[model samples]
Target chain A: MDTLTTPQVINSEYLLKHWQGHRNLTRKVIDAFPENHFFEFTIGGMRTAAQLTAEILAMGAPALKSIVDRSEEPFSENRFNLETKAEYLTKWDESTAAINANWEELSAQDFHETFNLFGLYNFPVIQNIQYFIDNEIHHRGQMFVYLRALGITPPFFWER
Target chain B: MDTLTTPQVINSEYLLKHWQGHRNLTRKVIDAFPENHFFEFTIGGMRTAAQLTAEILAMGAPALKSIVDRSEEPFSENRFNLETKAEYLTKWDESTAAINANWEELSAQDFHETFNLFGLYNFPVIQNIQYFIDNEIHHRGQMFVYLRALGITPPFFWER
Candidate 1:
């Protein structure tokens, strides 16, 4: 993808490509997480590792859908009420693929239109796509610290 | 703080209380993100630092709204498209206050109801809250790395 385009220049293809990149990166990070630590690490009363994974999996689709539909609710407001890690992961994968599948459903014009995203404010669809990507990156940064606090070399950031 | 309670047992107050903890922690980490870095860091093919903050600020209120409405779209699907550090931080502060103000709107039974969260699937509102906190933790994990990569010492995790 051309690296010089502004966020407003991004389209469904850019979003799908970036989404896949994020999913791939997330998988790489998850692979490096020690199973024991997965349920046990805490930094100042924060969540356990298992809980973090569940959180990532949980928001994958809702956030993407919100960006796509330009809906006015937080992504977490709608949840599966999941009972298992497997379920959350399944949804995560499905959401990744959904971004690819639904890319075409979003018109180029949609990218230019501004959305309210819950009466919070309005941004172009393209900026929203960039936000989705940036969001994943921010979380990955935290996971690396989790690994380091546990003394692990997280997979290279570029491997994803 | 009862670790024994299943996520379902935790209501919005529990979630909000927990999230407040996350905010405190993240605030410390955010402090380490140098004013210059706040809008400028990049690793491999990733978003600029300012964009990351915007995503975080954008998600806060919308995510809560989604939980409250049990809606399928992201609360940010269209509300914001910030480009400056000042804009993002302003929004972030607004979101933080919004969370504190409206947290009481949630009832314990609200935790039991399933939410669609962008049609990704259904998860209890309670679990979704957990996800939100964990999500913040995950992203904060990324911020920690950003700080470290920049050769900065992050505050004590507990300091949050």
Candidate 2:
């Protein structure tokens, strides 16, 4: 009798779904900001929400592609010179599709395998993926404060 | 030939470990703040880092205890009136131990079960757990900016 009692809780598909949920909420945060404020607003010397979004856009699909291809590309947030809020949203949608495409290429075992993210931090691929999600949540949290200070109500955090 | 090819990428133990890593990093963010600034610092009308820490402290173990005991406790951050940074750290350590204690009471199946967290936000137990982690990362991100503004180098985000 093989005595492993617990069922598997999270698979690759579930992880993608979890991440996409956060991405969706983040999109709403981008939409909530005024057109000018998205790029120009800064509080307490932090980067504007648009700049932070640019960093997030730089990560997801590119990191997944690196992990999938075993490529050693250095990290850069300047791949797209997005200026307008609409342009940012377009890039965001493009990245979302790209993430889905790249996600399909990952095997389950690949998650446990280590990948040097952006030729920089060498951690398990799963941690790298989690970092992508965590970093977004971190920035979104700042954006939430930004929204609040701007007298705009951001989306409910739990909705994600 | 049953053809489910992917293995489980995350289990309850892994989830706990992941959350604990973020918690550990967050502890460092708290420690990085100056004694007077921890409670007093604010930017762009945001709450002080101390108040944000209060929210993180209020959630973790208490939420787990709610899930374990099947209680509908309304959320409150006033359980401990931590006046100093040291007191907050002490409470954080206590909560860390308490989170472990409450975690032991949760069976693997409990992660999928839905619990109305804090008499609000009816989400799966797993999501609630993620929220605890996400919420901390969010606040820590703010603290990071606060630290940077005050000319202090916070811990590297990737170290978690």
Candidate 3:
């Protein structure tokens, strides 16, 4: 009778688009910070927005690579020479491209396969991918506050 | 020759647990702020944590019920008599229970189905669910910055 209803969660294509959309907004967030404040400012003992961004990049770039490479390792807080704001942007852009390319290497079924992230929290690939997105949104939320405290207008959440 | 690989995302049970883990961490973020600061503080022009929490609840509680009812509506930023911190927490707990009950009414196929979220974004049920999670992480990130600015210690992100 073929009475079983079809599965309805967004397809893999929508997932990629949605993720990239969020990434685009994050880039705008990176651009909103002032040069000096990006690296030096700290409120309430948290890492500088630059440092947080680096932490995100550290996880994002490597995590996707690990998924494709079938290898897992510990998450690092910083990567390479991001001493300057411009340098950070460069790294962000590089990571963005790397994400898209590596993203293509994943098959729909691969998303359901389990990959032990950071040698812990062994969840499905979809959950792991959401972790990457969730981490970015979380860090960007901090940057939104940083931008506001600096008397700058952070982009809207809906903008993502 | 069953070549179609199995989907690996944690089923609804794990999804609920994962969401609650993050919610528990967010609740701690709420507790870290002082009585007065909980409602009044803002960084970089973003909504205060209380307001952000309201937004999450506004979407979460209704969205689930709508999913169960197969209806869609625009999202609001505030709900109920969340005038005080305690009230907000209570509302959050209420929403949590509502989410669990409504979640049960949905089938696994519903996760893949598209519902015009907020009469705006038309993504799948899974993306919408992720949005609920991502939004919490995002707002909590801002709260982390706010807590730091106020000289209060925020909870660790990994605790989730």
Q: Write the per-residue lDDT of candidate 1 for residues B10-59, one digit (tens) a residue.
A: 22343465477667767667666777887687554355556655556656
Pitting candidate 1 against candidate 3, the one with the higher lDDT is 3
Best by lDDT: 2
Those runs of model 3 whose alpha carbons end farther than 4 Å from true positions after fitting are A1-12, A72-74, A107-125, B1-14, B71-76, B112-123
lDDT at B96, model 1 = 84
Q: Please write out the lDDT profile of model 2 over residues B1-160, one tens digit for every residue.
A: 1112236577677788888888889999999898999989887777899999999998888889999998989999877899999999999999989998888888767777888888897977877887788889888887887887788888988776
lDDT of 2 by residue, A25-144 (tens): 999999999999999988667789999999999998888999999997999997889989999999999989999999999877788788788889798898889889999998898888
lDDT of 1 at B146: 67
RMSD of each: 18.7, 3.2, 4.2
Pairs with steric clashes in candidate 3: A8-B112, A8-B113, A9-B111, A9-B112, A9-B113, A44-B148, A112-B8, A148-B44, A149-B44
lDDT of 3 by residue, B11-96 (tens): 56667777888888888888788878888888666677788778877877788787778776666676464888888888878877
Candidate 1 docking class:
incorrect
Model 1 misses residue B46 by how many Å? 3.4
Candidate 3 interface RMSD to the true structure: 5.7
- Chain A of candidate 3: what's the TM-score? 0.91
> Candidate 3: TM-score?
0.84
- List the candidates ranked by DockQ, beginning with the highest: 2, 3, 1
Write candidate 1's Cα lDDT for A1-160 as tens digits.
2122312222344346646876787777766777667667655455655666666665565655676776677545336654444554566677777766667667656665678754554766555554455456666666666777677887765454
